[model samples]
Target: MNVTETKRKVEINDLYKLSTAYDAQLSPDGKSAVYVVRKINEETAQYVSNLYVVDLETKEERQWTFGEHLHQTPTFSPDGAMLAFVSNRTKTNQIYLLPVNGGEAKQLTFFHKGASNPIWSPDGNMLLCSAGVKSGETIHTKEEQNEKKELQPLVVDRLIYKADGRGFIKDTYSQIALIHIDSGESVQLTQGDHSYAASCWSPDGTAVVYSANLSDDPDAVFTSDLYVYNIDSKETVNLTTGQGSFGRASWSPDGSYLAFLGSQEENQTVTTTKIWLYDFSAQKMHCITQEWDVDVEDVGVGDLHSWRRNPGLIWTADSEGFYFLMSDQGNVGVYHGTVEGELTPVLFENLHVYDLSVHSNGQQAVVGISTPTLPGELYTLNLTSGDREQITHLHDTFLDDVVLAGAESFTIKASDGWDLQCWLMKPAGYEEGEKYPLILEIHGGPHMMYGNTFVHEFQTLTASGYGVLYINPRGSKGYGQVFADAVRGDYGGKDYQDLMDAVDYVIREYDFVDEMRLGVTGGSYGGFMTNWIVGQTDRFKAAVTQRSISNWISFYGVSDIGYFFTEREIKSDLYDNIEALWKHSPLRLADKVNTPLLILHGELDYRCPIEQGEQLFNALKRKGKETRFIRFPEATHDLSRSGDPKLRLDRLTYIRDWFHQYV
Candidate 1:
């Protein structure tokens, strides 16, 4: 037998062995590249990340930092003599600098609220950083208050006070600061109740551009504006009007243009994000990708690559064009565009490009890619010739002895004749005539597309003798604007039909999929659909709802983004249109559910609060239905993807065991 026939199947513990490389940064001369490698510590049940550097000429790699804590975002200085990164080894994340020659890394900043997102200055003498500071506070303020052992009541004054990962908000605001490399002194540049994120520095180092919402009541408005802060004059100029959301600003080499990514429509969640250019001489802004139908951002969803960073927009050295990642047709790839509204594909492929770093010459770039069988790796691409060379072997050894199932892509017509993209993964070591159970996987973001990326969850299920089916229904990105907005008012209308059509198509075409042993599961919006599916039909033998929404009335107040997200996505509000909200809620039809459901939720998930799971479980129990509830403590909405390692494994085990019992 061949080596592939003798390989072992993937297991739940394989998550600890997978290493992901991200946040790639190329040096000024393009001789060396630095990226981050992240892996889980099986003993500690926590994540550990370190910096690694690879030489382009020799293709030799070496670890740059070693620690049990997290280290990320490695940026090279202008001279390429030193590297700056962020680490939490000192109890809080702070900037640290290391000389390329050799020595111990030195701490650069001591902000009490912590500092991150380091941007090197043009002259290489200073670093632009971001830190959280409360009102009337400076960057040098030291922590003096003792740790509280008792709980204190929180005072809420803003609609956007609480967040999913960060929990209850303190009055802290993220502000920009400057740190002197030699003197180790820090100066706060921006202040107020508002927060600011520094994007880039001008070529001459005279001004810096940042994004912030400066409205009197920022909670009421969802627009962000870019401003240029002049260093010597201490003056600020608003480059963008307060009508749209814009960020990720990149200055041209010639210093005559500024490029950014954003949408002109404020508070519209379904609108496509476009690329815009600001002309310095003309003092006007124009949309470059307005005619392009694709979304100018990476929107591919997967479980393996968490904390993946986007390169945003990288400018050419000649200031003639730029490079960016765009999502289209269930794939994210690199595209080149010029200042004169010219666009072309450079490296469009069947893989997801999650991170990118362009060389100063603009002819080469380093990208982090993930596919159906590959978790993640870094590759150097020749921008002109479209040639790729793998530079990282983080997963080569581990994958050699494993058998992974590849996804088969196809298109199916929905009931309304809308073409939808879908993928199916058969069980590993499958036979032609044998039947296997099938599981339908739904992605969150109802706005995010499920593309060609490695998902550990899907691999584990397939390894356990189950087929997996995933589809990009209406209201998902990578399609046009209208398709993405189709399910706004009609939550369970066409989107539901499209999903059902996909399942029917797979079962009819592939006789190996057992129609009687079907299962369904999803999180967030997908979770809501799982609940809806069980209530609408008894076809599915088992169902799993994760971080789901059952009642829109309570969700509108409890969820972090519920207040506005409900109004935008549901097209209704708690005060004016209570009936419309109730009409689309899955809890309204909870009495009709017949499938055995397993509800999973995080205790600290403020995005889709735990109450959503509680209400669904309670309703199903009152009806004397078959159901179970599993709650994870200290976990957020991303429990399946980025939660604690042990908890993530336990979740997968529970999901597999539940399906094994019922399906």
Candidate 2:
């Protein structure tokens, strides 16, 4: 099938359609546009995501690829004649090139492993991509051979053990690669056990800058250095030699400056998140957005009515300033930052913003917005008045035909008086004095936040006779750097308290919450919190921990980001306090857990690793406590959002079943 047809067959599972969004983009000339479409197939147990092109002038939309594959990372060529994207149509994800007008999509690279994050070269003839190596290829191949031959006598000795949904695994390692669009050849530009991840082409297209941690530390995961690779020499020169984790790098249009956001020092969890601009010629680093001492990321909600997430940062027409995301004053808004370091806020309010695109003219920007009462929709925003106009009517058909539950946003002070913000989704037919079963849904990203965006799980939970509560706990971002770091070195301390406090406030304030029949669920850090919560308190009758960290010691060596993340979050290395890591580990306290728990893990999860669940389940079983672990054989860390559609649905079903059995 062609590109447009591929997009047309994009069907989404009704249960969790809003888990992610298709972000639209405008071209340099603003004559045409690009957007992403996502679908989930339950029968196939897969997610179908692809890119589509539309001619704004002609009002035409077309797909770019076809077949049982996932396509993403679509970028426009400088001349706007070709589109570059990464696809797994060949079984392993790799870069593919296609014409914007339409034609047979050309396969650019053939790697035994998968590739991701494709960016067009300045000249548009070559595409830069990130390459990942299967952690234990030789052993894995042998496992496949043994399984096919009907033998089961392989040795099971490895530091990195079995992946829950996947088979025995070690880890995922990735470096940067450059694919030649015309020749269909690729070259590994960076090398080492220290993986180089993020990829971005310099504005001038002379160098490709990325984040890598080619560290001497054997288990170092977060020690990434900013480096520029010369395509001609196949050489990489390290830029930021300092010790810090750099994320999401973007170069200023002038190429003289490169920018990325990161914490400033080593072993610092609450370091101020600053936009650092490095001078290519001066070899110096200067910090931007100095006014606020808080951390910033995917910040700012432009409007609730539009649709999108992770609003893209666009440069002004003159390149004098950059327009991107910032959340301050308890709101998310677009802010324009000048070259000299003056930060100006453009849009603000209690809206969740994502997938932002700026018109070539620079006077206006378009974003996806969602409010408390609506599903996400696309909208065009006048950067000047904050006046926004709705664009596509995506879900009005389904929404108008069904009775939808409403979400209410409120803030309550924690025990320490730190203002904690939360979103409560009451059951559709919620009645006064009716005590409804409550599901305390926690978010991950110990650095992320709860927002006004529509969450399918929350709505579904509310529809299923449960009240859902999600809060931006202490470690959550948007509350300033201090509060975000407040949970550092004290993982289950204040963050747990904050979550429990919210539960208490909800039970006291809302008569609909059946506190005695409470259920808790979370992924990643939230998963870790759930595990910790069950260990510390039995308030929750049922608990589901998705891709959680049960033991920090095992986690530090097994997970893709475990090494640095462990130290970064715990404020110490594994040896620094192996006992502390264990003490802080939810598994260590598992003997105290009596809550009926459901452990949901992805077979391919690398972030928290599946052994987390293994350890927890084994402990619970030894204790003869009620617990069950369900492993999604082909899912990843994002089982709820990016995992197999069937598995995603099954995940909800399993949680509901487990809760139903216990609650």
Candidate 3:
């Protein structure tokens, strides 16, 4: 068979062939750009990331780094002569400098605990990064020496001791470290029990600003304040005074103003992120987007696994205006804001901008965008004229050969009269009047919205001859704060009705849906809804729930954020409102569920512990309800997204086969 003539449906393994691009950083002159590209190596069953550079004028893209190194966080030096990035080829992640003109990369620092987040000073001679150090050890001591000690028992003394991906909390604190590019010498800048969350340098390079929560009970406070550290005097100045959960500080070009993103805890877990500015001359702080009514930062949803953090503020050369990505109405757009609190749309459209970098001149930008049909790619946009040109085509050949379904967006009224945004994607290669099975997909964060972004899981279901239906129900972001906050106290109330109404609208409008063969699935918050839906109704023929929460009473003290999350979302307490907590728990209603459900969970998931899944499974099995449980070993709560590559493919296969047999 000829290569182009052979047409095959998207298999579970095709995920390895797809590559993701993100985190674009433009050079000083605006003629070149560097970004991160990630692809799976099937032979090793690991994902590898490397830096790629492109000529903005000619639109030529080429890989800059090679070999087994997993390169990321690429940033150009202040003089644009060298590019610094973090790689893990030496068993631990460390910063490496690569000449812009093309030469062998040189490793900069060899810290004991590794290094990350390299920030260039104004002079480009010294670099600033953070590393974790032990309580009684300096940066020169080897962490491996302590690891070789006789198996000593771990003694826990703090309220927060363990994390999901990082395991148990050891006696290590992340302190800022300064490295000289010329001498390759590393010096510890700050020391204490607390860790610096993030940092940036001033224009003069004499002071470094960072955010940290230095309270006595840091874990219980849920607050971080900005602090400035002087290089010569080694003195520190508190900036924000521990007012809010603030970080991601950016310095203005003239060193007169500092900007950061944060929000006051109005609804706690449902608070919206906004931008705040601090003035050096007036020594005052103010909220710049207090009236914008939009969530600042990229909360866009996509099926691909992404580890890219939010970028710093893209300040203009004149330091009068800045650009950022904010979540709004089913899409993330880049917006421009003035230092005086004026906001305007710079690149508003139906798309998801994961990360971006603006030119120093503020005339153009390199953005990482993903839409419904595009997996992910890079584009250069003219800030002045609003013109966009594609820069990378990583999956062009594969996409052209395969037939895919496009999402059709629509709006409907919820049971409570609120407008709801929903989408339906027909099965690939659908014929007129041909009925197909349907799957209703829900997103993880009940706070996260399903919008104009590429969803690989949904596409896999579509390729398997199923129509996919998704909706931005109440409690989903992209709507106003009121709508997103409505589902806090009401878990299965209006939000449940909104999902059912979405299904009804689709069945009434589209005649190609097989109403009897309906399937449903979701993860995290969506998983809770799936558990709730199965208990409330027997309409869904089959269902799959991943990383779900079943019992709130036990969950209060078990999960990582269970203590505060229960207080905020469920509005209940273990000591005071045990009955109320049980009332909202899905395990309480497990006896009512008759739908065939396949419980998928990660054994190492601390957010919604594996015990939650076990409890639900045992409840259903004891009641003679059809249920099966499958657990992925050594996987975290993000198993579906960032887990082992082989395990992810197996999960897709399991999902497809379960629906195929039951639906």
Each prediction's whole-model lDDT (CA): 0.93, 0.72, 0.87
Clashing pairs in 3: none
Error of 2 at 607 (Å): 3.7
lDDT of 3 by residue, 1-663 (tens): 654346566778888988888878999888999999988888898989999999988888788999766899998998899999999989788899999998999999787778899999989999999787878887777756554568778898875777788777687888888999999888898787888865689889999999888988876788889988999999988989877878899999988899998877777888888899999999988998887777888877676736767876778889998888888888888999889998889887888887788987889998888888788888899999989998999989878767667899889987778999999999987889899999999887888888888888888999899999999999998887888899998888889999999999999889999999999999999999999999999999999998998888888888888888888898888888788889888899988998999999999998999999999999999999999999999999888888888999989999999999999
lDDT of 2: 0.72
Ranking by TM-score: 1, 3, 2
Off by over 4 Å in 1: 145-150
lDDT of 1 by residue, 224-264 (tens): 99999998899999999885999999999899999998998
Kindly indicate the candidate among 1 and 3 with the higher lDDT: 1
Q: Pick the candidate with the highest lDDT.
A: 1
Clashes of each: 0, 25, 0
| TM-score computed on alpha carbons, candidate 2 | 0.83
Per-residue CA lDDT of model 2 for 1-663, tens digit only, reads 533222221112465344234567777677766776665544565667777666655656566666667777677787888877778887888777778766878877666666777778778878777766554431112223344555456454434344434455445566677777767666767654445665578776768888866665544333567888876766877878855767667777767677777765533655656777777789888777665765555643211222234443466656677777766444556777777888877776776666577875677766766665466666667887888866555576556455556768888999989899887888766678788898999888777767766666666667677788888888777877777778888999888999999999999998778879999999999899999999999889999998899999988888866767787788667676777787789998888999999999987887877888999999999999999989989678877765565777788788877877887
Considering summed lDDT, which 10 consecutive residues are worst modelled in model 2? Answer: 3-12
**Candidates in descending lDDT order:** 1, 3, 2
User: In model 3, what lDDT does residue 33 have?
Assistant: 95
lDDT, model 1:
0.93
